[model samples]
Target: MAQQVNPPRGMRDFLPAQKLKRERALAIIREVYAAHGFDEIETPVIEDYARLHAGLGGDNEKLSFSILKRGLRQEQLENAVVTGTGDVLCDLGLRFDLTVPLARYYASNRADLPATFRAVHIGPVWRAERPQKGRYRQFVQADIDIIGEPGLLAEAELITATSAALARLGLAGCVIRINDRRLLAALLDYCGFNAADSDRVLITIDKLDKIGVQGVIDELRGFGAEFVTPAVKLEHILNSYSEAACAGDIALTESGIAAVLPADLAPEVTSALISLGEMVAPGLPAGVRLAFDPTLVRGMGYYTGTIFEIAHPGSGSSVGGGGRYDGMIGRFLSQSVPAVGFSIGFERIIDLIDLPPAADQRAVALIADKAVDPAVLLRIKAELIASGARVQIATRTKNVRPLLDRFELDGFTEFANVRPEHTSMHDLDFKVFAES
Candidate 1:
């Protein structure tokens, strides 16, 4: 017997029904995106290692699937500086997410795209990491982005469009948790923290969703005594804020934030929070609630302004998230191109949805005895196909029973037994065939 082949770990083969379900779901998502004026574009799956290592993707960069340089000589492989080149093994790697490639695409084709491009990209992204339910080493990300827009309008459209997509997918009670990186920066300054501690602190606080307040405190203590004092202050402030927000007291959460912010930045922070609430409330479709969480701290290193996440019950993790990455594309062109984008975690959302019932499309299995005339079998097959039934033809013999079983598995609904000499026929509906 030949050995069975398997796909790589954390990857999967989509069976026919599964593929159809996913395609139907993607069509719904694309419709929602297209309604919001986003145009589709595609980029290559592989990118230069230099781009992947460009410090924009945060921890996702560490999980990049790098490939070895082609035709490397012995000296290049052995020597660290054979020709003033470092011992770099890989020159290219698979893209970790669509956002990176989008940025690169925009950089290369800036002259062709619109001044403010509303783009949609739905495709697979590879991440070399542990795979579990709703998480994969190879998965699809559906992203819609607005580039060259500086105002909060881009953020508003992103949030509203994503919420609409989820609602169209029949997911109710979804919450959008939002925050601003500038607000976080202001808070760090208010706490008398250094600029260098910003990202580390943001990464640490991002874990707050997994670990509770005290757990965060303990971990911050690990960063050294400098983090302990701010951690204590953060613990007090965030506890008070979360309680108030949970108790349905928005004003209290506001006051708590105002108390911690510096006098100069406090007013802007308060106003931005209010604007976020207002922008999300009016155009956003039903079944979506927006929350302003000061502790959001999304780990994407490139998010320079607003950040948000969309989550629902049973997905274990957020089904979608993205934010303002004003600086990411700028890295390529050495010029700023304001961009805000959101991505639906395509596979995660699929896990939560049930494929709606399919409409009736009757199928036929035309079975003939081996002793039957071959011309008769061919005529029956053509007739069944012409009569709007999906036809499957198999010879009747001792081995035919299992073939009929296989036919049923493939969704054939009716079975016909044809004879050459007797000029008689036997017919069975799919249910009777199943029982026999």
Candidate 2:
């Protein structure tokens, strides 16, 4: 027997039914995004390694894939690699995400584009993270983002638009789960942690979903954070923040506050953070909850303000997430352009909605007498082709039911070929469009 072949574990092959379900989801998402003035754009599947690692900081370096090609071509693939230092070689890694390439696109094409650009894209992205259950080494992220919009309303629009899109997908119990990194920073300062240590603290806490609260505490303590403070003497500082976060006015003495946070940051910054928290709280839509999760630190270092993530209580992981980045673009352009964006994990969303896994099949078989006029046959073929049927000419002696059974087994719903009467082509054409 010939050797059998199968896809790598955590990857999949979608047949007719599954492909249809994915198409349905894509249709709704595109419709919603287009209605909001987002023009569709497609970027390459590979990107330079620098872009992906730029925002990742050090936490996500292990998740990137490097390109082996050297020089300029390798330079192009560098951003796609999860991790690798020095000059490029030959093998280019696949893209880890879309945002890095989009940023590069914006910087390179600034002259040809409008000041404010809104783009929507749906495509595959790869990651080196452990693949299990809903997670995969390769998956799709349907994304929407607006650049050069500086106002908080732009941030609000991303959440609002995403909410509208999800609603169109039939999610009644979904929650937007908005959390501002600025607020987390302020709370962190209040708890007495500097920027470097603060980032470490947040990364540990962000894993709260995967690891329970106690697990987070254990991780934080392992990172060398102080277990006690003057205001609250608890051994675990995270619990103190968890409790003090609800109190409107929790103050610390000079030694109390100075021992925890950096003194270089202005005191007024803390006040402004408190006010922003109040604004985002009442601004959240009904059925959605907003909170100041001191532990809600996103892994991306580029985010500067107002970060948000979407989650369904019944689902095991975040469906999508985004945040404001006011300074990242400044790295490439002479002027800084504020930007914010979100990406919907298409695979995860489709799974959450319980979409069927299958692919659509296209097969057309035509059986007609050999004596039929060539002109007539040509005309018949043209008409079916115009109607978008994949017509296949077959011998008149061949049995159609058996051919149809094979089509059915292969996942083809629409079958067409040479047959007597107009009903033959019309019926098959209708079926193809219906599946489409």
Top-TM-score structure, candidate number? 1
Candidate 2, 336-436: lDDT as tens digits: 88888987767878866753323442445455555655566667667776866555554565555665555444444554444444433443333342353
The TM-scores, one per candidate, come to 0.82, 0.71
Q: Which 10 residues in a row give candidate 1 its minimum summed lDDT?
A: 422-431
Candidate 2 residue spans exceeding 4 A from truth: 1-4, 55-58, 70-92, 225-294, 354-436
- Candidate 1 positional error at 242, Å: 4.0
Tens digit per residue, CA lDDT, model 1, 233-257: 7777667665443322343135544
Local error of candidate 2 at residue 43 (angstroms): 1.6
Q: In model 1, what lDDT does residue 402 have?
A: 84
Candidates' lDDT values, in order? 0.79, 0.64
